[model samples]
Structure formats: C-alpha cells, structure tokens
Target: MSKVEITTQNNTKKITLSGHFTAMDHDQFRAILDDLQSGEGCTACAVDLEHLEFIDSGGLGMLLLLRDACIKQKLALSLTNAKGDVLRILDIAKFDQLFKVVG
Candidate 1:
C-alpha cells in the first residue's frame, strides 16, 4: 500500500499497488476497499501486484477483506503478477482458496 492507482474503463476496474503493504497503509487501503465494497460501478476488478515489494499480516487481512467484499457484491476480482516474497506470502496464507491469482 505504498502507492495505489485505480483505473476504470468499459466496466472494468483495476487497482495497482506498489511498494509495501502493511499496517502503516491500513487506512489508505481501507478506503479503497470501501469503494469496492460499495460496488456502485465496475463489473470486473483486478489487483495488479507486479511491483509490490513487500507484504505483512495486515496486508493479507486487507486482501481477505477485499475478497469478501467482492463476493458479497458478486464482482469478479483477481490478483495478477504476484512473485517473489509477495507470492510466497500469499501462498503461505493459501490465498488461492480465496481469490483467483495469476502471474
């Protein structure tokens, strides 16, 4: 949650996050999560984590929250381009059971 960029076009929404996702960025991420949960717009969503440098337990929690929101709203959500430590952390958390991840 170092930097977050969100874009929407043609009913598709994408959120790109870079740097570190940890407790320090909780507030910022929660805002984004809230927007998604509202789901006033956007038919599909993807989180691009190709440039993410790090992640912690708090970050994982945010991810779970996102998954739940998407499910509740019935929106298609996925994570893409995860690798290195980011990928490892997600694997350790068995996030594959919760969200569609592609690299």
Candidate 2:
C-alpha cells in the first residue's frame, strides 16, 4: 500500500510518500503528478521518500517522468531523505545527477 500527501507552502509543493511505490500505486502517483503539472506558478516541488519502504522499477520510472515534467516546466524537482535501498536504486539509475537528491 502507498500513501501520498501533498502540502503547499510558499509556492512550493511537498509530496510525502510512504509504504510501497509499485504498480499498484501508479494511479495515485499519476494523479499527484497531474495535480503538480496543473498547479499554477509552482516554483519548486519536493518528493519526500523517508517513509517509503519499497519501490519497484515502475516507481523509479514515475520519478523520472515527474523529473522530466518539472524540468520542462522550469520547476525545481527534488527527492529528499531517501535512504537504504531507495538511495541505492537512485544511485544505480544515475538519477542522483539528473534530480536533486537532498538529505
């Protein structure tokens, strides 16, 4: 199961995710991405995966999709507080260089 919570402050959006990020959660993830894309004048967006327990390849793909969208829109997209396997996956994917990875 996955849970995504979006909060906005100071023109920035924070997406906090927990549990597993898998095919089962794609709908929720896509909905959130659509919302972010539709939001007006957002300066930055942060995806917090501190509480995320597991993520599959599809989840990684979703992250890349969001990153590309944000880049095209000139919005800052950041991944924060990733650790353990999640961090390793991002590193292996070389997404560390493509997206901002914050502790």
Candidate 3:
C-alpha cells in the first residue's frame, strides 16, 4: 500500500509520498493530482520522497505525469528529500535532468 499526503503553503503545494509506489496506487495518486489541478491556485509543487520506501516503472511513469501536470498548470515542480531506494531509482532514471530535484 501507499500513502499520499498533501499540504499547501503560500504558492506551493507539497505532496509527501510514503510506502510503495506501484501501479496499484496510481489511481489514488492521480486523484490527488486532479484535486490539486482543480483551481487550487498554486504556483509551485514539491513531491517529498523522504519517507517513500519503494518504486517501480509505473511509479516512474507517474512522476512523468506529475511533471506534465505541473507544466500544463504553469507550476514549478520539485522532487525533494529523496534518499535510499527512492533516490537511487530517480538517479537511475536520470530524472534530475528533467526536473528540479533537491535534498
């Protein structure tokens, strides 16, 4: 199972992802992003992956989806606090080349 926690501060919407990020949780994450897309009025978004435990190719696809969502909504996106396996996966995918990733 996976957990998604969202918070808004000033112009930023932060999404903290926890647990395994697999195909099973795709819809839940999509719904959460949809909610953020619904006139939430944010100018930036951060995905906090510090607590995330695992990810697969489906998870990578979702991250791409998030990137597109942010671009379409004219929001800056950050993938932050990623460590261990999460960080490794992102690095292996070279996602840093595509988005802003921060510790």
TM-scores of the models, in the given order?
A: 0.90, 0.92, 0.95
Evaluated against the true structure, the overall lDDT of model 1 is 0.86
Candidate 3, backbone clash total: 0
Identify the runs in model 1 with alpha carbons over 4 angstroms from their true place.
37-41
Candidate 2 global CA lDDT score? 0.87
Ranking by TM-score: 3, 2, 1
Ranking by lDDT: 3, 2, 1
- TM-score of candidate 2 to 2 decimals: 0.92
User: Best candidate per lDDT, number?
Assistant: 3
Off by over 4 Å in 3: none
Off by over 4 Å in 2: none
- Predictions in order: lDDT: 0.86, 0.87, 0.90
Top candidate, metric TM-score: 3
- lDDT score, residue 13, model 3? 92
Quote the lDDT for 94 in model 3. Answer: 96
Better of 1 and 2 by TM-score: 2
lDDT tens readout by residue for model 3, 1-103? 6798888889899998999998888999898779778736789999999899998889889989999989989999999999998899999999999989999
Lowest summed lDDT window (length 10), candidate 1: 33-42
